[model samples]
Target: MKTAVVLLPGLNRDRDMIAALTKISGTPPVTIWQTETEIADDIDLVVVPGGFSYGDYLRCGAIAARMPVLRALKEKAERGTRVIGVCNGFQILVEAGLLPGALMRNASLKFVCREVKLEVANASTSFTSGYTQGQIIRCPVAHHDGNYVADETTLKSIEDKGQVVFRYAEGTNPNGSMNDIAGIVNEAGNVLGMMPHPENLIEAAHGGDDGRALFAAALEVAA
Candidate 1:
């Protein structure tokens, strides 16, 4: 599958993402810099990899959201392109307005880095179809602001629509997110945003391959 990863200034996980995707899909992913005004033609999926984009200034992803590449990202998403945003990438999606809610500082106000247990809330989305509903997946999360919060009404609507795709397991909430939500999908299911680093779990080098299924799912969808 032909996949593209947008690389912004300060992007640190582009190589990690490319390595993961190359292993899972047997194809090297292209890296598109944020300054590029156009995404490559025939790209099957687009990933906004994790990093302190724009040095996390003015909020984690605020500045990067307005970059030239994001304009193309929005257009591609609108055209039903598969998009996945991880960690700071998730922050960028929210700031870009492609996804809702904002990622805020951990409720306890500390940076967190650890393996987290997450339950698959809904396995029907293109990005998560590899897991069963309620299955536990171990993914690493590293960030100072991984807490996810939304107004009650929006949260309720997300639940009502089955858009809440992943949640920290009971009693294992690492960031104090509302309802322990770790990831969510859009109504169309073509776009996904999550705080966990699926790329980190993609190979035996990382001690596990639980997240390989996520990229597998993306490849299947793209095919």
Candidate 2:
């Protein structure tokens, strides 16, 4: 499968995402700059990696969401292409209106960098199909604004539709997110946004490969 990584200033995790995709798919993903207005239709997956884009000015991912690339990304998503946004990328997706809800500052009001347990709340989505329902996996998170929030109606809608894909498990909630949501997919199930950094824990060298199945499933490759 062909993949592309969106690049924006201050996004430090692009390289990690690139490396993971290369290792998993056996090919380097195309790099899409912030100004690029179009994404090739051949690209099967497009990932917006985690980091403080625009230095988190005016809110996480606020500025990056307005980039020309995001417009094209929205178009791609409308056409049913798969998209994953991690951490700040998750913030950007919400800001850009590609996904629902908002990511607020961590309830602790301090940066958090640690491993958290995530339960596969909805394993039927494209991104979580490799895992089984109710499975718990370890994933690392590094961010200051990982809190996920949504209005009551919106929250209920997503939950009712099984869009909530990952949730903090075993009292591992680090951000006080509503319903302990750690990740979610769009109504169409083609777009996903999450606060965890799965790219960081996708290899044995990183302790274990619990996160590899996600990328493999998204990339249509063997886990």
Best by TM-score: 2
Give lDDT per model, in order. 0.89, 0.96
**Candidate 1's TM-score:** 0.96
lDDT of each residue in 1-223, candidate 2, tens digit only: 9999999999999999999999999999999999999999899999999999999999999999999999999999999999999999999999999999999999999899999999999999999999999999999999899899999999999999999999999999999899999999999999999999899888889998988999999988899
lDDT of 1: 0.89
All models, RMSD in angstroms: 1.6, 0.5
User: Tens digit of lDDT per residue, candidate 1, span 129-216?
Assistant: 8999899989999888889989988899889999999899957788899989999988788889999999999778899988888889
Off by over 4 Å in 2: none
lDDT of 1 at 139: 92
